[model samples]
Target: MADVFDQIEWNVQKIFDGEPVCVHVGNAMECELKRHPSYPKFHTEAVRAGVQPASSSRLWESLIAMGRLSDLDGDCTWRLVILDCIIPSLRSVSARVSRDFRVDCEEIRSDMVATALEAWKDTATGVAPRNVRDRMVKAAFDAAFRQGKATSSERPMDDIEALSWQEPTAQDCKPRASSIIDVDDIRDADVAEQIRGERAGAMLQRWGCFDAVHSFHDEIRSGHRSGSAGQAVKTSRSRSLISNPNLYYYSSDLYPRHIGLSEAAGVMGIAESAAHRLIRTGQFPLPVARVGRSYKVSVRALMHFKDIPDAIIHVDDVENGALHARDAVP
Candidate 1:
């Protein structure tokens, strides 16, 4: 049993190193099976070694079930089994980074793949248990999260806020002067028609009604001529132009900069009820801020538990020094 485990571990490490290994029946034929291509070769070798075909087939099936081998697209590749085990954890790590750091999903996934490749290169020979998936996840996540932290540090938090919804102001509505050609000066009929359209578009833009006009035009093109249909289109267009302030406030202000109880639980990958219990028991690592009936947590404070640098300061912390107050409290 010990010898078999050692051989399996050795073969797995070789697969990680980009070398292929054969799936064999038993210890007697193990020496002859290294890097053999197909099941036919294994069967022939086993039969020559006085082993029955039924025994060899059963052993192959058991190995496949145990994830010691993989038959992908008619080719037996052992490393793919390891990859299958780690893929779900990799996706979870990617989600966590996207949620916490607000990094692009594609960029985070690419970074994780690179991290996995690098880690595989450095892996030593050892008999890892079937549940080594979690370790792979943590390793990949740590690398990707560190890269995300560096990226977040380069971009100011205010930039993220600015990209989110901001209330439209007078400055936003201020129209710039645009020179329009007189339609009478154009000789070509088509050119004159184009100029008139451009002038109309400019006027609509200045009045902040271009989208409404566009929607109306689209409805006309789609043959929705009824008064009720026109009214519905207008209403939908107006709603689309106005950003939802609540969604903006929660996603931009509360999520990344401050960790509320629910947000903290999501970051820690735990249940909201469990997170609330931890906070009430004072077992949560960071200090929670009480803002009226709701609670907020500093992202900086959360970093302390992870031993990461406190690069971010919440807006509430800057204004009310809530972080300092929470720190000062027992």
Candidate 2:
């Protein structure tokens, strides 16, 4: 009864609109727009099928296509596709990755391309394409893992044993000084804290904080005055922190101890005027409590410590840290 294009459009729309005839991030019933960018027409016809917006039929096909779902041939029904081949592939596609992909992060962009290829392979025509994508994804992951691995020093085997022992046995250690400088223990804090004692001592010794501050200051002045910053509000100590071998102890973990320090330290290196400009534009990674021009905009010659939580974070870490396990909720 319907025209062929209309039929094709309707079928496609049904695929997009009906409860995803596949599984995606979760048991969500939303349309699989990311799986098929041209799914709007298909969604329109799904409404005609008496399928509610919450139905999985609308999302399933795209989910399966994206390799986010597995067809349940045994049950003769659709369910979330568990990544059975998890050890070889880290089941890396997740809600966080999906959301980030929607927002256009580089890693997420790479992941979606990987997913699209996997989805294509489900059908006979896409076999070669899927193989190509599989190889690419493996290469990308291998490269990333190696890069992450390379940023560390060769730790003495005994030091690793000590740290590993601390993980299960250490009831959160209270630093000797009971000062509020230890932001890691604070509850409900949103920012990170200062690196005190040995950590700060080492950084100050190796990098010379004042010189680092001046270098970052010059970068900020040059970038802002010359209009060449291009989103990189460069930092000397921050760069040092990233590159330092001493700090590598925390680098391998999800919530690196140093990040808490970096978040709390604020931009001590920049001028108050430059800091104010950077904060207004949200270019600075540090948080600002107020947004008015009258604020002096704290800039210290030494790193000023602010109290923040140990676990407080943005969505970006979800991919960097929590890509394992089944807890990702999109």
Candidate 3:
């Protein structure tokens, strides 16, 4: 059996190493850089281990979002600067920076870190805004997705036939505007059409009116005659094609059911006499008690008597009768 100290160390080591690769969890692979006082030893060790330091842009956003960078305290900024300076030496391998992803990877000077942080604090509330930029970017992405231009090759662009740069003149510089249009008028027309259809459907199903009920039944039975004619149009256009060709019939109405939970509990202890009394009475404070799968006569008696100094109780039977017996302890 492992000693208590050995068990503690084992648990601690497991937390640091994380679950094995077989777990396939996202956060499992992410590792953090360790801070040290000596630069030479730290740099050499980090480089040898191929530990890459996180970039400033990503780190800044993360810290801000986690509320750690709020108020931009001088001490906190200094720590960040130290981490930033050591990052290049710790990085696994260098790669060419692209124009789209380029960030000024300048190593933050230790002396200036405090001043920069203080200046940032003075300028703003030291709080980063709730990322409206990300929301806007996602909206643009969704728009692209809806337009069927998500993939690079599927994007619509005019071919060689539309080229007109050679004949361009000052006349094209004039501002061109379209004719007057009422956006609300278009919405109103669509709303009116939907309302009219709904009202017609309701009138056909009206109660206390024999003609209306008969009309409703007739419409319901006649629906099958229309067959696939009323299905949604699904045709490939010039640049984009309809992805999902399956026609989904509209559901008229639906009501969903709700789910609830029941509370339950299990009890275990060592005193054979006490365990027997409780099992017989079923008087444990825990409201919903059940005999657990792991419950064993010997194990329960030993566990219950563990609280007492010198009492020794041993159970031999593995069956449920012994487990739930009137004299069984824990």
Question: How many backbone clashes can be found in candidate 3?
Answer: 6
Best by lDDT: 1
Q: Estimate each model's TM-score.
A: 0.32, 0.19, 0.15
Off by more than 4 A, model 1:
1-76, 153-265, 269-301, 306-330
lDDT score at residue 66, model 1, on the 0-100 scale: 36
- Pitting candidate 2 against candidate 3, the one with the higher lDDT is 2
For candidate 3, the 10 contiguous residues with the lowest summed lDDT are 254-263
| lDDT tens digits, residue span 163-198, model 3 | 101232563333321112222244654332233223
| Cα TM-score of candidate 1 | 0.32
Candidates, ranked, TM-score: 1, 2, 3
RMSD of 3: 30.3
In order, candidate lDDTs are 0.43, 0.30, 0.26
**Superposed Cα deviation of residue 175, candidate 1 (Å):** 19
What lDDT does candidate 3 reach at residue 197?
28
